[model samples]
Target: MKTELEKMLAGELYDASDDTLFAMRLKARQLFTAYNQLGFEGTAARHTLLKQLLGQCPDTIDIQGPFYCDYGCHISAGENLFINFNCIILDCAMVTIGSNVAIATGVQILTAHHPVLAAERIKGPELASPVTIGDNVWIGAGAIICPGVTIGDNTTIGAGSVVTRSIPANVVAAGNPCRVIRQL
Candidate 1:
């Protein structure tokens, strides 16, 4: 039998309220709370907290605090990644971010979703999918990267856009239900 955490990471339906899952989220909240309280001068402290929080991260990462995530250990990020303040990653599943990526403030990378049917939704089991952001990508301010979506390398997502599908590399995408604006 798969554990709740195992099911969650496998993109399957799982109970978010499970005791173990709840404990993990609680731990993440505590770490992020401490991280958010530190000043810019507390770089070393901030890094230490992030190292303990995130699943996999490079030695150098510039994530402006006030960052929130559901299970910090589900997130893996590469080098030269700069995520601005107020960034939230609902990492019910894995969130893989590549190197040299710049995510603007208020960006939300959500991997959690619910069943479309109202009957299923009422059952309290939630579903999730992984989100992958390629290297050298820039997610504009307030952009929402939906579940199971992959943003290719060198792509630029415009501000406030809602990405519902995969975006190919070397293009500019924008707007609600973000579409390719132009090839770069």
Candidate 2:
């Protein structure tokens, strides 16, 4: 089952080349432009963007104007979730954001990574790693959550931190390659 899911996700994402990804992103950007530019009020537009970004969303959610995602159908957001302006999610894989999560402006969540090996980087197949942020987590402004990471519940990621790995529950984490600092 794990391998099946992995294979399915790979087919949906990393099987394509950089050029392919760029084209796909370009199309998505056009759609986002049309969607956000739709002259709707706050509540109406928020739902419209959520519906565009995720397959299913809880009612108690609000993402302020101007959000971007590679493909909205691959992402799933939970209840009472709030993402501020300028949020971007590279949801090449399944991105499951939990309930009551608050993401500040300029935050980027990515679920895509390419090969690091010099010989195989170009020839090697792409990799898709899902990201799961637990409930009640507050992601600060300009934070980046990398692929295959799981941030535990009630954790606060400080502003401008780049989370490269999993973080434990109930703590404060911050840094370029983010690590647990201390209990919250």
Alpha carbon lDDT at 158, candidate 2: 95
lDDT tens string, model 1, 1-184?
A: 9999999989889999999999999999999999999999998888999999999978878999899999899999999999999999999999999999999999999999999999999999999999999999999999999999999999999999999999999999999999999999
Q: What TM-score, computed on C-alpha atoms, does each candidate reach?
A: 0.99, 0.84
Question: How accurate locally, in lDDT, is each candidate?
Answer: 0.96, 0.81
Q: RMSD of each candidate?
A: 0.6, 3.6
Off by over 4 Å in 2: 1-13, 17-30, 39-42
Residues 144-172, model 2: lDDT tens digits: 99999999999999999999999999999
For this target, which candidate reaches the highest lDDT against the unseen true structure? 1
